[model samples]
Target: MPSVGIEGPVVSRGLDGDGAVEAPPFGNANEIGWYRGGARPGAAGVAVFVGHMDTRAKPAVFYRLGDVRPGEEVTVTRADGRTAVFTVERVETVAKDDFDAQRVYGQHKRGRAEIRLLTCGGAYEPEERSYTGNLVVSGYLTRTGTG
Candidate 1:
């Protein structure tokens, strides 16, 4: 997306039996992973895209995601060659422990196309090999165009 200034293949990620969505590998920092079970971009639901915030030695594609502000534009190119244009509505950082499944994954409004861009945030724990919080950017579809 323009705000992030990078783009890569978005692979489908499915939920496991525990109903948890698996994140992309750390080595694939350049690409984004889409929750295949969630709404597709430009569709009437929440489409989720996730990327790595940082690696052990360097920053990843979404290291700057926390800096994105409301009103910024986020564009997603669909497999059908159509572009889904979105306007950022809000940005939030919530602790992983307090992550609200319903708020993040639930549909906000009926018939409204929305998206969530997610990445790691807060303190990183070396022992745990994970961040304490998640950086989420919520956007709503503003328009569509040919890619």
Candidate 2:
């Protein structure tokens, strides 16, 4: 697996009652969550993973997610013991109010496999206990291996 330089393993997380995938708990700052309804990491569609940038006490697993540059590698190990290697295409921080759902979650390429790593970013709003924007790292499948 491509080393992401983070702590903890990714766990499967399903959508909430509102049909939205929940992020990993802030208390468990090292864990990442994969959206169960999305495509598999190396499948022919976009797969999504979400995490927390930071908690009240410290930085989380994806705290440096925004630092990922184009061409960097991200590796995900599936339950079947296969690893999907993805190359970062780009990274952006979008305001929550102006988030483009289509670009963030829609299928961009017809048959290529893609992945999006998401986390809270921008200014923290203490009153709302949230951030004003989201940090998204977009990547595409580049290779695979047995893990």
- Candidate 1 per-residue lDDT over residues 62-110, each given as its tens digit: 8888878999999889999999999989899889899998888776777
TM-score of 2: 0.92
Worst 10 residues of 1 by lDDT: 1-10
Where does candidate 2 stray beyond 4 Å?
1-4
How badly does each model clash, as a count of residue pairs? 0, 0
TM-score of each: 0.92, 0.92
lDDT of the structure predicted as candidate 2: 0.86
List lDDT for all candidates, in order: 0.86, 0.86
